[model samples]
Target: MSTRTYLPYIACAAALCVAQARADVKIGFSAPLSGPVAAVGQDQYDGFLLGLESVGGKLGGQVTTVLREDDQLKPELGNQITRKFIDRDKVDAMVGLGFSNVLMASLPRIAESGTVAIATNAGPSPLAGAGCLPNVFSTAWQNDGTAEAMGKYAQDTGFKRVYLMAPNYQAGKDYIAGFKRHYKGQVLDEVYTQVNQPDYAAEIAQLQAAGADAVFVFYPGGMGVNFVKQFSQAGLGKKLPLLSAFTVDGTTLPALRDAALGTISGAMWDVALTTPGNAEFVATFAKKFGRTPSHYAAVGYDAARLLDIAVRKVHGKTADKAAFAAAVKAAGTELKSVRGPFRFNTNNMPVQNYYAFQTVKDGEKFGVKLLGTPLSQHQDVYVAQCGAK
Candidate 1:
């Protein structure tokens, strides 16, 4: 009877010690999970969970807890969420920084606290250059990368005059500037519209009057759906060649459908890409979520995989912030990214390929078909300005 009682006590003590040894990995995920852009955030969140599941619901063999927040696509709200993640929850890492504007708003706090942040979308120029932070990394494209690819494609295709349009924001300006860097042609006009503006009759009229050879735009989410639908409604879809980056993607294609067909876009990844493991990722995501995964989802998935490699390398010792950051940076090289040709530059932005894809009818449904790569093994131009030695 004494031996039996003592044996139960010893077993209970061992279980408690094992539990203490495996600490929970806490992650705070913030995104615009409401309003018009909600689909973008939802895809990212779903993909992230899928990735975590692929690793057996643990990141680096540690049980992971994710705190989700919706910023509603507002910078002020994003900043508040960032603060809460850092101050109250004390998350080991943060992801899904939202769009470019929201990311910019939260940049200072992330920079100050030395938090390990992996951006699934919204990589602005400042983060890649003079204002670069050691703890920040983006599994998404730099703001200008896709635009630059479109610009080069226009230049190569002999589109002598191009009209440009985007929402009036930091990303919009960066895209236009990036296009201008490569096009070396006549710019009919650069139009900035209000965010979430539903009407585009005025812009369409301006484009028609300009008589440009092609038009390039950088609208994402609901804005893209509205713009492309209205542009097609204006009867400009056939008359003027439409080109874009993020304006016609999986997120917007379902809404735009036939109207988005024949439109060419610049992107880093798509459901149609044949990169190793991408087909399975696409299939699994579709089966799990009942929707086609966008490039945003791909990035979100990659972000999780990246953290898996990093956290495992450091054995989940994320308390040493600097060491964790270093591990993340090095993880970029080790990961066989679904996007292909991915490695972090000295600035922690991706050096990858950007391709031209055209929306097409895939059997009974709509999808994108790869046209040709516009840029390969490309690093953003701002890397030259980065202070990383």
Candidate 2:
């Protein structure tokens, strides 16, 4: 159930010392470097790489060369790609595996090789509990953590007869499970479909038939683009009112355009998260990327920042895998996350705010704007099973 690596523990400094002595500690980055989810993967890639650049290619006080590979969003491909990073590339650590399926496949590879795996994205559940490895750490929130915020919101707002839909897969199931944990409502229906099915006609037909008062969905990347477009075209946008996990934020919002208007989403930060850190990040990203930074980009940037801080903690010395892992964990605790304060749960997932957001037209551009305030703050109910103190 867990791809946890079992390496004998060592003194933090000792482990770091060994790693630092190595000429160049290699870090592996396995992600959807191509395919439909490339936008999401690219965002993650840019953030982590940016962090590497910012820190001068050193992590934990040791100089590093990032060995990048494309999983192409396939689990088997992910396994093969990870093998190359671990075996041929001789990487000492891994980071930025973008998708859940890819993360699941790569975990065992990391565990077996005694390499630290720092996830910039994709925090699947199994790794958080019984399967948790001391070697694997996430700079991103877990799979269901954000959806759990929506569940709590539904409970707070008193929305009964809500319909839920997601791509039929491990992550999709986890998202709905997290929502139902707090929702305590009449779930009109819980629907699932094949992952990345461009057309949601069949599901939309079923949704229209379900006649729920409100709907919650977890469709990211191209799937989000298609679902939102179909929802608007089918006239469900007005009648049912849509609420989302804010994963439908900056990345896919451009694709949805005006159709995303008026829909409610849940996230930790919007383009409007009025803070100095957020303002600088949003401004820089928009100017450089020529578009608003979606929550994905924001998280990507945050991941890079977190990595930089952690690398600095160990002085870029990744030779000591155990020390590097501890340094990363300590760094995570210290980050003044743009979403506000955050700390790692025992399961190594994030406990942070999840806000409700809306897509609004920003003149010639579109962005995810704040809506209804933050629903869940420093929240991740799955923590009960997370084995955190």
Candidate 3:
């Protein structure tokens, strides 16, 4: 046993360390890029890239490679993409796991592999509660948070009766539950429509017949456009107070235009936010992308900035999954988000401010104006079930 015999072993260990240090940060981004919600995915993707560009085209001083995929808002496609990112590409992190259904389908694989996933949009309640995974985080608010804000507003504003409507899905159900959690008023009807349903004439008729004081609906992307347009065309815009969450936003506002005017929606972020760094962000995004930045885009931008902090905290060593996850969690508090009062709850969902925004004419175009803050520093009701302390 010569002492010199250990030289090869030491050299081999050193080589391995150098190799790990030089490894690039690989992120896989999947979202519904080609379907009705394409704008939602596109805005998020663009914002993420903008964030990366702001950080000198790197995450934690490591060269980064992002593999983008289109899930087309389909759970099956999302599952396939998640598997490919995990089993084949071996990405260090995943972002934009698609809509709620798609995200739910991909969660098991993500948790099983212990891969870090930062969801820019989807925040299903199951993931926020007993199904909470340390590897997964949502930069976006919980699916219920904004709805809760609207519910609280409706309740506080003394609305006696309201009609509720949403797409039939996990998020839609959660949204309705969230609304009921705060609004103790008479719910005239709980209308659940097919996801991406084109026509809402029947629902509007039923709502009109119900004679509710106000109407609350949860529709995003193209659905929002169609719903608002129809609601306006039906002359309900002048007859009934239309309140919503995600039904009128930057992603849908272009098509919505004057049709969405006077619509009050609950949200966590918008161009109307005067939070520090938001003005520059909005300006930069609009200049770069040629449109107003949506809450989805804000979340995506925040995700990249959060990762920048986390990856740097770990000194470009994202290979240590535990360390990387911890860093990301810690980065939640360290980063100044474009969305105000943002931090990760124990369940890895956002504890942030939710506000009421009214769609209005900004000069000649439609944009949201901050009406008031309904829920401040709100954490989801399901966080207690996460058992994360």
- Candidate number with the higher TM-score (1 or 2): 1
What tens-digit string does per-residue lDDT give for candidate 2 at 160-259?
A: 8899999887788888988888788899889998887889898899989987878999987788888999999999877887887744777788788878
Q: Write the per-residue lDDT of candidate 1 for residues 253-274, one digit (tens) a residue.
A: 9889889879999999998789
Better of 2 and 3 by TM-score: 3
In candidate 2, what residue range of length 10 has the lowest lDDT sum?
1-10
TM-score of 2: 0.88
Better of 2 and 3 by lDDT: 3
Model 3 local distance difference test score: 0.88
Clash pairs, model 1 backbone: none
lDDT of 3 by residue, 295-354 (tens): 999989999999999999999888888889999999999989988888899999999999
lDDT of 2: 0.72
Cα deviation in Å at residue 294, candidate 2?
2.1
| lDDT: worst 10-residue window of model 3 | 1-10
Regions of model 1 farther than 4 Å from truth: 1-23
Superposed on all Cα atoms, the candidates' RMSDs to the truth, in angstroms, are 6.7, 6.9, 8.1
